[model samples]
Structure formats: C-alpha cells, structure tokens
Target: MSATFAGPITRSPHPASSASDRIHRLDIRDLDELSPDTTESHGEEGLTMRNQKEIRETSIRSARKLNIRELRALLGRCGMSVSDYDIEYVAALHGADGQPAYGASPHDGCGRPLPGNRGRPLILLSDLALADLETAVVTIYHEIAHHRSYRSVGHAGTEAAAERYGWRMYSEFVRQSA
Candidate 1:
C-alpha cells in the first residue's frame, strides 16, 4: 500500500482496535499526534534493570521503516527458502473472511498455509502480520513455530517457542554479520 508521510515515521506500538482500523490512508506528519506515551513508559521505576532494558530494546522500530530485504535474510537465517514464499509488507490486513481492513494489524503477525504453492514444506508467515519490523520478526517465527507444532500446544505455546527460537536466529544473524 502506498502512503505519504513527513517527519520521523511512526505508528502506535499497540494493537489496532476495530473502530480505528478503517482509515485507508493515514496522514502521519507528527510523532506527537501518534504517540502520547513517547517520553515515558507506564511505570519503569520498579522493574529490574535487565527487564527495563529489554522493554526499551524491544520497542517497535518507529523511527524507520524496516527493510524487507533484511527480513528476507532473517527468514533465510531461520531456514526458510526465500524465493519459495511471497512475502510483502502491508498497511492493514484483511479479515479472515477477506473483507477490507485498512490498518487492522499494527501489532500482530500471521502465518498462513500455502498448499497450492507447488509443495511448500511448512506454513509461512502470514503476509499480513507484518505491520512493523518487530511485528514481522516475532510473527514470522511465531507462525513458523505455530505451524510446525502440529496444532498441539496452541498460540501461547507457539509464542513462547517463537521468542526462544527467533532470538537465537536474530542473535546469530548479528554475530555472523559482525
């Protein structure tokens, strides 16, 4: 989806609710208009230093739009054949029923089955779940784990597995690139 914006790029780091997900084109001219909680966290005073650090480090990459080629390299690091799947960024995703939702997946990622792709080994990332970089990485791994788990452990289990697995992949990528 094509959009025009000025200034530092950003969107809410939270999930999109149904009521606010209808806009096809967003006018993003200012960070103040998008994030009211930019300067402070909800309450970081009591958390451990590591926990606080993790929160800060794990923030969505709002300052820059993440590169898709970089993410494809991430998929390659995770062992998915880059050319086999059709991966692209989207502004908002459609519902499961395929209705138009302009910005429904700001903080979510999805993995979908492509049985007709001439023989894919497993499910791949839901092309829709990638509203941002953090969302893309997490969702890609989550979907990979989710589909590979054979529907036994469910979403939460898949999420846990994805964090563990995706972290290793990301860490390895950083190490190798360095």
Candidate 2:
C-alpha cells in the first residue's frame, strides 16, 4: 500500500488590529530624528559630533553619499585593502591612541589625525557620514593619505605637507592607474 504525505499549511493573521493592539513601525533614521537627543549611542560604540563635523567639512562633490561596501571595493580597485588591523594602525598613527576614554570624542572620521594623546583609535564611519559610492572614494583617499604617512614615517603629518602630499599622491595614483 502507498501512503500519501501531507504538509502543514501556513495562514496569515487577520489584517485588522483591535483598539487595544495598535502597533507602530519605524526606521532607525526616523527614530533617531525624532529623539530629543541629537546624538545617539549604540551601546558603547557610536558616532560622535566631531566625527560628523569632519565629514561635513571635507564633503566635496560626493560627500555623505557613500556606503562602506562601496568604500571597500573602491580601495580594493585602487590596490589598497583596509582590514581591521590596518584601520586600527592608521587610526592610531593619526593620533587616535586607543578606545576612547570618558569625555573623549567618539567617532574619528575627520580625515585628519586624532588629537595627540587624548583621542580614540576606533574611527567610526556611519551611513549619515557616507550615504553611497562616490563619497566612499573621497573618504578612502583621505584615509590613505594618513596610512601612507604611517608606513613611511612614524606618523601622519599635520602641516601643509600632509594635505598637499595626500592630494598629490591620490591624484598621481589615479592618473597613472587610469
């Protein structure tokens, strides 16, 4: 004798909710914007006001429009891969010593080195700072400037040479590769 198999059927719940069961849905951004506190911390790790400001200032044609994946891919295309180790090293070399201390800045995406002896090395980057692809390249190039300096000398420079050299190297690399 042959036996027939039966499968469990799933059903959707009723579409309507009772007066006592009202529910609300919201995106993180909407929640953030609605909160009284302008800055929100995610557990111990979160973006800071200073970091947000830095991204804002360097914002050129494509600022606050780059995603992290796009930034990573762009760096890979440029032959520079930034891993956790490299990120920490670069952040530290740029003056962000270690995990941020109490009263210290939270995010360190300023494109500039952390303040000497009083900053963190995590260097957080959030969607608010980089929303899509083009800005990722710009942000990565800025970070590369610091990394190259760390590799050559002990740390990244803060003088006019730093910015000049960083932009110069970035331009040269792009032109030659293209």
Candidate 3:
C-alpha cells in the first residue's frame, strides 16, 4: 500500500477515529527515496538528516492542526483512556532522571503531573517543532504503555513492555495508513 497525504485535513472528535483512519500511509520502502543518504542500520532503516528534518516539519504541521479531542481519540486507539488526564504540548521533555525525551507520562521524571487531576495520568508531548509526527505519536503510545505496565506489573519491567507496545502500535499505524 502506498501512503500518501491527500485531501483537506479535518479535525474529528470521535474516539473511533484513528491515525490510520486519517493519515495516508506511505510505504516504508518509499522513505529511502526521500533522501539519497538513507541507509539501513541494525535491521532498521535510517532516514538522512535532511529527511528527518522534513518529516519533523510535516509532523509539526499535522499535530498543530489536530484538536484536543482528536488527540484524545488517538490515545484511545492506543488503549489509553485519557478522558480524565491532562494532555499538553510542551517545548520538550526530560526523563525522570532529567534527560530529554520525546514524551513523558505522569511523574515519570519528565515533569510533575498536572495538579487537580486527582491522580489521573498527565501526558506531556514534546513541542512539535522538535519531533517528527511518528515520534510524537509513538511517544504518546509509549507513555500510555508505561502507564499500563506500571499499573499491571509495577516498574520492574515496564521499559521493555512499553517499547514493544509502542513499536507495535507504530507499525500498525504505518501498515493501516499504507
């Protein structure tokens, strides 16, 4: 399936609407053509610096156009119920240990959860300017996975599970979009 972004983008508040339902999916193979220096690494393809920048810009534009309801719906698709949580787009994120990250979740070291939510998780998205659409979306899914893992199994094995969940969600999005 060829992924192509087409038509006028519209915002929908429906929880059933997913990224795959909205954005066109481009074939992963096609990404290489976008940059001459693209290469395969560690069994994964790497985009050139220029291509990365382009993807980031495009992602930012898409994210800015997405309304809060749409963002919430996207999270719902990832199996996260953020109806009570606060989702904020910020300049950047730092890990629980103070290192930068693409996204962070409630009290995970990126930042403190928003006050007054009564313990509902807070999802902090990095500024769109600093992340590609894929990274941003995946980060949201990743954080949600962390929330789920923490609740289900405690913190001992959250990272591996979250990483797997995030990548699986991302792959599905790509495949569905394609």
lDDT of every model, 2 decimals:
0.33, 0.32, 0.41
Which window of 10 residues has the lowest lDDT sum in candidate 3?
A: 42-51
**1 or 3: which has the higher lDDT?**
3
lDDT of 2 by residue, 1-178 (tens): 1111111111122223223321122223222323222222211222222122122333333443444555556656755454431222122111122221111122233323343233423333434325444323333434443343333443332222222332343453354347
Cα lDDT tens digits, model 3, 1-178, are 0111111112222233345432222223222222322122101111001011122334445334344457667656655445655666666544323333455554333223333244566666666413454555555555665454334433312333344445555665555445
Ranking by lDDT: 3, 1, 2
Candidates 1 and 2: which is better by lDDT? 1
RMSD of each: 17.1, 22.8, 13.6
RMSD of 1: 17.1
Better of 1 and 2 by TM-score: 1
lDDT, residue 16, candidate 1: 24
C-alpha positional error of residue 5 in candidate 3 after TM-score superposition, expressed in Å: 36
Residue 138 in model 2: lDDT: 35
Off by over 4 Å in 2: 1-64, 84-135, 147-152
